[model samples]
Target: MTKANLLYPRKERVRKKQASPNFKAAGKSIEQRPESINKRDNSGDFEIDTVIQTRAKNECLLTLTDRKSRYQIIRLIPDKSADSVNQALRTILQEYQINSITADNGTEFSRLSDVFDPEHIYYAHPYSS
Candidate 1:
């Protein structure tokens, strides 16, 4: 004889709202940046991004690339918060000759103004560029 399993009531899963900060104050649009940066002939032009480990807890990687030289700098970060990212960029910028930085409009990159000149930092198109 097979024993019947008891049915239990399940609670609805609560969805967490994703963060999307208004980058207007801290980030600039790539469209408005000077045409010189797009050429990528200058050594100081760079691109920035982040990598997060879904399996790990509170660990992220901050990545920077010099558009002209194709050099890359990768560092482990504590989290994906804007403050953490800003501080990381500030420290890295100290060593690099950063003329401009082009980044995607992610929440973590919203406050890059802390490290870069407002006029030199720009965000790529949300869809594609």
Candidate 2:
């Protein structure tokens, strides 16, 4: 095998640790949503989700879309921390009136009820979406 004096590459393969999803929902369950919201009979009801930047792990986009109107609001957040998400939601609340919000079971949304009414924040089932 060494007849041609070929150099053997000595390199170690490092595996990155995968982060587990925080599947705990922060607020009320989606099943608790009122008929007005469930049927999309109102304009103030909205759905919230976060889009993480692929290249910048620390940066994310918070999106809110009105269920009835399909209008959307997108904001750039510095991180996925609950505090950052609350801050972004607070700012949005000042400009818009959101009657209710539906979010996934992400840890970053654990504090959503602090910014909005606890009774109005609904969470989807874990791992369903």
Candidate 3:
């Protein structure tokens, strides 16, 4: 069966209302991100995300993309602990000289604040609970 047919048996309907947060805390939202980083014409800024496998497996993939050149770097890891993720990020940043990064709010990324200075990195809030 096709992906759409297998994933959704029927047309889905949106049921939840959009909830807004009380305030914009540091690294919480990207709404007011620096224009220099979003322009994609200047290099150094990056977007990061992780991909995980099935069955409670610790295996994961870390992906980073340069905002300007669209260049990407992928790292495979055996586990998702904060220390491991931080080590991986440090290695990558050391090699690439990343000045700033934006990432999703995942446990693996919580320690990002420790890896990079808060003034240099940002994290998006979790999509949903």
Candidate 4:
């Protein structure tokens, strides 16, 4: 017998199937995003992500990107608490009159409605990946 079979002669490996279908395909496609996002001075739209320190459990950096001008802002914070995130967002929004933001599904952003008007802020669907 080959060495591969000798190691586990009676065992069989089964491929695992996904528990659910890819959900991102069900949402509004990126092609559907406004063409204005590519033009200069499109100030209201942004993409945001959080950068966490590998060595520090509580340290994080919030990164925001302006879709049009490709402008970026980063905020370092002691922790990922909602209060901290809200404060950081408020500071960024104050600097620029942000109209909308897109972010991945993260618990840190769950309190967005408390910080901004729901009508003004839009969230990408959680399952969209």
Tell me how far the alpha carbon of residue 37 in candidate 2 is from the true structure, in angstroms, after superposition.
0.5
- lDDT by residue (tens digit), candidate 3, 1-129: 865668657666988754367634346566556888877767889988887878756888888989888899999877877788888988987788787888876677777888887777777655643
Residue 4 of model 2 has an lDDT of 50
Q: Using Cα atoms with residue i matched to residue i, what is each candidate's TM-score against the true structure?
A: 0.75, 0.79, 0.74, 0.65
Which 10 residues in a row give candidate 4 its minimum summed lDDT?
22-31
Taking every candidate in turn, the Cα RMSD to the unseen true structure, in Å, is 7.0, 6.6, 6.6, 5.4
List candidate 3 segments past 4 Å from native: 1-28
Model 4 lDDT at residue 115? 71
lDDT of 1 by residue, 1-129 (tens): 223443654556887664357425346677887777788767888889999989889989999989888999898899998999988888887887788888987889887776677778888866463
Cα RMSD for predicted model 4: 5.4
Q: Write the per-residue lDDT of candidate 2 for residues 1-129, one digit (tens) a residue.
A: 643565875566887554358544567899999999999998999999999999996999999999999999999999989999999999999999899999987888888888888989999887667
What residue pairs clash in candidate 1, if any at all? none
Tens digits of per-residue lDDT, candidate 4, 1-129, equal 775768667666886544245544222334455556535356868777788999987899988888877789899977987788889988877877776666665677667767766544445655555
- Which has the greatest lDDT? 2
User: Between which residue pairs do clashes occur in model 2?
Assistant: none
lDDT of each prediction vs. the true structure?
Answer: 0.80, 0.88, 0.77, 0.69
Ranking by lDDT: 2, 1, 3, 4
Relative to the true structure, candidate 3 reaches a TM of 0.74
